[model samples]
Target: MKTDPERFILENTSVLSPPHVPEIRLHLASEVHDLWLKTEEDLEEIGLPPPFWAFAWAGGQGLARYILDHPETVEGKRVLDFASGSGLVAIAAAKAGAVEVLAADIDPWARTAVRLNAALNDADLAFTDDDLIGRSVDFDVVLAGDVFYDSDFARALVEWFVNLAESGCLVLVGDPGRSYRPTAHLDPLATYEVPVTRALEDSEVKKTTVWKFRQ
Candidate 1:
């Protein structure tokens, strides 16, 4: 069955709430799309804490904005959007002229969202929910956005990314100053002041940084 992207967003919108609900508007190439994220009141209705989908992080938004600004980074490159949520980064890569873009996530809902968003933008993306453990693929670049919230997961992901970088694949991480960000073997590439709603607990606005893994 085909996934309804708008319905998925609507159903998951109440999972977590931010302090202020902002209508996020982003352009996929010449096409523009908008979605209203949940506010704190919405979380109360769903009975869940913040970071419900890890979709509200500023890092993803920053990465999407970066792709829109610098199309050359993805042009002609084979890209992978790791832990893709809402598929924003994957869509941006595809719109920016990536030869091949894959959106990989453990959550089935996230993969569904990727397919839906790709269709909405009139782009094609490879979606997968395969376990990445001990799996390796050669690609020009791997893009990760806001995947450092949890310590265990962050450690595992960083180790995996570092291994990929060592094998000559460029890995970029878009982080919102998460505590679990690895300090070593990482080089800061760019920083952006992302306008973020307080979706996570006690966070107001996040000034995210984009770092490249140094081999």
Candidate 2:
């Protein structure tokens, strides 16, 4: 903990809404925020984490949209938002009527960001900085967004998700076609043209899809 996460996030982000999921608000790094421009080296020098929690990613936006639209997916069930940056998807689960929501991420900064964003939306949720990729949990629904960027990480997550799905927990993911996303054991549920900043994505709008993990 080199940086004071709460202070750093407050100074570097603005309260804003992800375009596709405008019903929920978050503390995000906008174009005017230097966080949107800082390179990894710059962030390291400033004692900041990668700051994934500072932006609303396209995959998160699409997943949040789907959850908000299809309340039955989470309503009255315990939900887990894995790799939850900024707690956007977790908040959506709460808003959609989940009885309990847990946002899990390994980044310490993300914990603070999730706290702030959840408070902004008055969405009650819990957060854990533990890496839950290989562990079993007590949630009824599992939602992940934009996690399949690297081959090794993707492989680990896919395996864990498959196990969770087979155990009868509803597993869902929002992906923007990352290179290593699973090619099997998944069923597409919904898709959206998620609006995003070019700084974070290849294009201003990403064609994102929500998929359900199946046995």
Candidate 3:
């Protein structure tokens, strides 16, 4: 990393609440356009991946809202927030009375962002960078948000999620109607009109859905 992730995030973002889930606040990039452009420029310069962690994506916002509204789903359970960008879902799970919560993402910057955001909310969350796909999961609930954007990755995720669901782990996914979502394997749970930056998404508001993975 060229610069300190914590310092860079603090400098580039502001502590703001996602519109869909105002109860939870996160450190997100304030100027979406500028940050996005800079992220593209920094792709090779600083080896930074896409700045997905720098925003409160619609899928995560909807999922966080769902978890907060339906606390019983995660209460007293060990939860895993897979591909947890910004740790929004993980924080919500912790705040909703989950016995333990783990936020896992492949990007190290995302882990840093999650740590900073968790501190801002005073939520205790464990973080991991390992790709746990096709591996045994010990958690009682598994949550993923906006992970089906890519076909190959989505295919892999669906397989792993199916295994977890079959093993009695409650799996939930929040998506804004991405093309790669495995709708056949999901049961609709909830939906929300999530506010988003036009610079990042096609529209200012996205119709996001929370789906429970079915075995």
TM-score of each: 0.77, 0.93, 0.95
Superior by TM-score: candidate 1 or candidate 3: 3
85-190 per-residue lDDT for model 2 (tens digits): 9999999999999999999998757898999999999999999998898899999999999988889999999889999999999999999999998868779999
Q: Encode model 1's per-residue lDDT on 1-215: one tens digit a residue.
A: 23354464555444332222122322111111112224234323443333223354577777776776778888999999988876778877888899999888876356655665667577778988887745698689899888888899888987888899999988888888888989686898778777565434355567778888988
For residues 81-148, could you state the per-residue lDDT of candidate 3 as single tens digits? 99998999999999999999999999758888999999999999999999899999899999999999
**Per-candidate local distance difference test:** 0.68, 0.88, 0.91
Write the number of the candidate with greater lDDT, choosing between 2 and 3: 3
Top candidate on lDDT is: 3
lDDT for model 2: 0.88
Ranking by TM-score: 3, 2, 1
Query: How far off is residue 169 in model 3, in Å?
Result: 0.4
- The candidate with the higher TM-score, 1 or 2, is 2
**Which candidate comes out best when scored by TM-score?**
3
